[model samples]
Target: MTHTPLLKPVWLSMTLLLVWLLSACQRETDLVEPTTNTTVSNTAENETINKWILENMRDYYYWNDKIPASPDLTLAPSDFFDSLLYTYSATAAPDGDRFSWIEENADDLSASLSGESTTTGLEFMLYLRSQGSTDVIAQVLYVLPNSPAARAGFKRGDIISKVNGQPITTTNYASLLYSGATNYSFGLAEVQNSALVDTDKTLSVTATVFQANPVFLDSIYTAGTKTVGYLVYNQFVPAPNNSSGTEYDDQVDAIFSNFKARGVNELILDLRYNPGGYTSSSANLASLIGKNISTSSVYFREEWNSTLTPYIKQEYGDEFFVQRFLNKSQNIGGNLQRVFVLTTDGTASSSELIINGLRPYMTVTTIGTTTYGKNVGSITIVDDSGKIKWGMQPIVFKSFNSQGQSDYSAGFAPSIEVQEPLVLKPLGDITEPLLNEALYQITGNRLARRAVATGHSLPALGSSIQRKAGGGRMIKSLTAFKTAKLPQ
Candidate 1:
């Protein structure tokens, strides 16, 4: 029998009852009702939900011991969840939780993990019109292929200055764009002499359930006698639907197969916009690029809490937490000694995993800005008993490369730092700033000095996907916990 690669469907078959080391606290059945006025609709139900949250956090949270001894159980479910977190505060607790999140609907959370979501497909960056200005402009990043934004002709670098015919400002952009609305109209603008000049143009789009294909674009480039393979991998999803199917992973494998067939000697793995997904796909990508690697080669190691560490060992054996390279037939790492990874602040979790995991095996040169720096990984926790509808994606482990290094919380600074220009170029284009720098570094080609006009460019406030749910996340499959049972 062939070993099936673990995917989302198999991971969702997890049993929720895991034996956890609980702190000394009041039992869930002994909880008292709060006298204070609260926002929760059903106090009893919310308490039940909070009980579930507390139990899981105590069992799996990286900072499990840091959870409060007596959290407010009467608070709203989301608030109660927050109260249990050792939340990261720059001055107070810098190393605290930064990525643990709870979603009301586990289905949405699961869909997000697989790159499916109800979205306008208009991924963008919000920038202050000018320094110290409240006026904001939304610059389009790459839109999903067949979604509303793409259908409305939204391409990368298009600027939106108004929403619903009103000029967008810091105070109203969120309300205008993300107000649980399905339809939206955007008014266009152009950067003229350091100012946004509104145009007589409008684009209307309707948000829908869009399954973004992680493989955005792939091409083979010939730069200075070197056959180069450039892949714009936006996420680490194996498939669009989160099924057992490996559609997206197959696409990556096929791309690598083409690269191998064409004798591509150099590789430019563009992950500048990648925010991470499944570790399975990350391992797949690494297997395609890692030099002299095999199923026995260590890709990364997981460090869990003491309770889980020993439990996993006893339940699943020693090699259970260790991830290894897949034995991919189309691997091209043998033809190349170094790989160029283009990155940005959005490059995170599994993206960083690929970079860190490959460094021990080959020369991994990164171009563009610093990475998002998420070395920790998470797991999707859903109550299989059907009583709890909420899903918890809590930090479960910290991952280290084979050298036992996992210190990238502040992010990885690029080997060749190239800040992409405000005026974005089409991805996979040779003239693009980040890719150009990578080519220059590889072939000794002169780097282009493209200057952003002094007052025209503003620092990006944020992007649509930068802080997206599950961004910089590496999820462990539920199959690893199949044999789990609550302590008697």
Candidate 2:
């Protein structure tokens, strides 16, 4: 079955529901009692919002039939919303609904979707020096450009031993690292005599509103006769304000354009720390890398619920269900046959979508660890009233590649499996283990390996650590609407 478009029939479904609810309210006049205008207005508004939520769920939710037919409308919106999730069975193990969430402010939610957030702009990995030990050390992953952390001279591979003069332990790391503090003092350290020794150097950083640019790092490398292009894309966010003409996407296009001019024959896409974003951006990236693929060929497919399936089929036709590769002037449709993808647990959603979507057209070799398996996408819904800005992001559809494969909930395994090295190496450095592995595969020549200094080795951090630090596979959502609207 073909999948639905990211541009869903949300307004159409919402309008039909509102019309039905207005008719029902007229018929059930007895239920609403005569009261003060203020009280009556509040009650009516709540009823309208509740009715709209239910109707949208019925029409667009992936498990629409599982929603109860007679849920209490007077309950708090959050509680009422939870009661509608598909919980499977009481005896079954809990696979919590981690995706669906309601935002109190639609504007804030919209900003977050556009990759704007307040932070010190630091992405790091935490590791325990010994198994089950409290001595936890953090290795800097990558710092966002123009961020507070970046201004403080923090870079990839910097070891952080202490925060605010307190040593980092498993018990207190959460409070010290992720307690949403505005200002923090970090102590630099190095391995000395088999122990983490503070170098007496301290740097303080203040968290501020930082616009996270998804295109973190992009460069072209010369490996003998092969010109390799490497891009460290952190998210799949499109241009801000939902503007057309590829404002954000043009950043990528410009990079590929340089690669095309440079006669680049190989591509290395680094999504190691990406947690997914807009689906349209993913499709665009796939198109740029898939040089030989035809624009008319299907990139991915979507599946919707049964009740609205035929209606969508009749309304938008078969083409609406399948996203095809876009033909663009900047696309690097070069002499390449295979692409290399660098992934970790943080690689998810549209990241996985790009990996899966490109497989049918080219040879994709994934390095590093397995991916975060998320074959589903969501749409954001807000109430009709401009007063209440509450927005709902619910998983509405599951996506599949052209080959009809979407069973990768467990994640995609790496073709060349290698864990990120505990001994820090600067990103984009040829000596970096993951990048070195990719170069080895591309050039058929092994690069010289550097010996790790004794006492620098640390225990492998569990996936749970990544999850606790908000570094694993993420819930990907689609916000493709040209403008916010109410169901008229």
Candidate 3:
């Protein structure tokens, strides 16, 4: 892996990864100066780590002003990190922080943010076996191609009732599914006649370190005089294999290049499983779809805390806060009037940003369900000294579109609502529920519906156990801010 100088701290929305290189002479305090004194009790249990946490939180957290002046220093690092957040509660604090988190291993967190993790590549959702029962069933959403799960014949819509011969319940599912085991034997089941029928069939798979490519699928469908481009983009990663290059972003460009070359007019961006990643990639995507835009056209803007905001303004001027569209040769927005987005509860952060950012330029019609409401972002802080093993992802900024619209905290509701049915179809199949709807909207002719055996579909519990990272995030390089010399 190529390590940059500013790898110690990365600014992110919800799921963001950026490695920046800052000047060797620049001090960490140049951008964020710790408020608390350094003489706090270091001998207390976890005080040393907690003190470091407090200092960073005080400097960079979006709700920095709301944090208590003197917090409990004796709490564990994770607990202490939680105590400082202006937590979002449904009734108590509806507008508080909900995405900031701390992980024990910074390396693991970094790897996960970069789309690298150990897994069976089983993306799934959890559903209650019955309306009132605690028993849970795991439905395979979409297995990563060539993954262990795919090699084991786990396809979309496959159901898992048990793991290691033990029934999956609401209480034990997390530990049973994510037990860090090297291998697993899944007990299979099927939804027959609206009832879950357990079968004696079992399939076992092993977990291995895998790096997923965010560009899942892309194709073109021609109907009469209209041509549509369909892309299933699962994440916004700019690269693969922890490289500093923009390989993934370049692949997206190439996909659009093909779309534009093929005379495609209509577009369907599938972001149902995209949690969010690199903001730079998001801009790259939006630029390709935003009609009549240029490199100077404002794409989105960032709003940091009071301290860093004014400092950035003073150092780099107002333009520093704005991100502009990149001039790409493969832009297809010029040939399109509207774009359809496929979404779900899992769609978040940079995913939402794309929708919000493009609406001002074109017709952005969303399908499927409401998004995973997350408009704010965080900064990934790892101890450069290597003494503190924990990594802190603190919400450091809120994002807004070019028109200054940032009020989608409850998530953007779909214009045309459709849910993924209990019986799933393989993605990229034009007959799939979401894609079918998009094609119908474009061609004005709906495909013949397949009759179902029963009207009952699995109740969506919104619970899932998947090997993915970062939902609702945008990442920016701190090097942009560090390059501007700060006053001593």
Candidate 4:
């Protein structure tokens, strides 16, 4: 007997459901009732000494995915804390290169992963950069091509050996990577490994440091007859911890209200590579484009009760609630007419939830290649054995349009496909001619054949054509809700 995958034929609704507890919060749950030792006062709070694993480790088994055999773990709670969370150990083990220094009260304090976190690249620094730091970026993960770093020829594993002639080492990532003068001219070396490389093994490059927060509305798109509402949404950092973040409750209000005020009809949501920040952030965005928009249903959620028998997950579901960041009045298609999004493979997690959720209500169109097909979300576990593991699982809960379309694996099929063009003359500079294509189609204005960029297949100027869309995954429709779309 074979199996299948579950997908949501994306309607641009928010698919994110709040679940996993942050490492600190999880530690609070696992703590033991303190003893009555007279030495320590009652008010003295227990200290949790554990390396914070940024991602969830244990997860559900999709039929298709190979289920790793569960390991036997037996250790006292305190010992479990030390062994599992490397940061909690007397001496932390090196994670790749340098992990951040862990402190008990440092939930609000964190740095970029030695290399960029795969799920969160530079976008993670929006807050860190705002607060200001004197650290160097020793390594970066490549989430998108033609990005500031990728266009600069920065690959996933490239290590930073020097910044502006200053040598970078593991112990000093914060100094060389984070600390820098704004718009300061700096030369950097890309090393194959952390080992100080000779000139031959490294590539020298330069970058300007700006505050991490990306400003939206920098440019209003009123390119004649194009009824477009342009909103710049990048990255999803949870509230409070990240300074670059606007309050999850009020951010969406401003974005949509501005679009309505601008007399804009169509929407252009730029999420080129928004590594998911907060599930709350995603829910807020989804409420904007959602059609009927139910408030009291499972959006998406998870559970882990390894302590009890079954020793696994007790249950999971997708639950929904009204997000704080919403307009008091329902404005489905008044000032706002339709949606057009810019996406890339680097667009993942909450980004996927947003695109996947808003599918039905708006005439949503995506301009880019395929999205990062991450139907599954993650949950982390620091077991009693002192072994830290990130547990990942796709939630059983989902959202569907009035038409009952929930195709998780297939993702959102773009009405139009556009590719970013890279050129050599400028070296790392990129031009988004695809944006022009999307703008043209939405405005009812056909471009001249010569006006269209050459290469790749899509509806060209003067060509009325039907094309093949890239997204086709196994989605979980409402009827087949109970384990029908389970991954095989």
Among these predictions, the greatest TM-score belongs to 1
List model 2 lDDT by residue over 92-190, tens digit each: 623323355455555555565666756777777777856667788788888888899999999877778899999988788767886668999999877
Which runs in model 3 stand beyond 4 Å of their true positions? 1-45, 446-457, 463-467, 483-488
Point out the higher-scoring one by TM-score: 1 or 2.
1
Model 1 weakest 10-residue run by lDDT? 16-25
Best first by lDDT, ranked: 1, 3, 2, 4
Pairs of residues at least 3 apart in sequence or in different chains that clash in candidate 3: 12-378, 13-377, 13-474, 14-473, 15-473, 348-472, 349-472
lDDT of 4 by residue, 417-476 (tens): 665432101211113454566566665544212125533221211100000000111111
Clashes of 3: 7
At residue 35, give the lDDT of candidate 3: 36
Measured against the true structure, the TM-scores of the candidates, in listed sequence, are 0.90, 0.81, 0.89, 0.48
After superposition on all C-alphas, the RMSD of every candidate to the true structure, in Å, is: 6.8, 8.9, 7.0, 14.9
Predicted structure 2: lDDT: 0.67
Q: What's each prediction's clash count?
A: 0, 3, 7, 65
Please give the lDDT score at residue 89 for candidate 2: 42
Model 1 C-alpha lDDT per residue in residues 1-488, reported as the tens digit of each score: 11122111213321111101111001111223444775556787887888877877777788898989999887877778778888778899988777776778777777777888788898887888888999999988788888888888999989999998889898997678656678888999986785569899999998898888889899887756788898999888887665878899999999999999999999999988887778888899999999999899999998878765776676677787799999999999999999999988888888999989999999999988898778888788777666677777777788899999988887889997778666778887777888777777666663343422222358667776764554667765665465543332
Q: Hey, what RMSD does candidate 2 come out at?
A: 8.9
Is candidate 3 or 4 superior in lDDT? 3
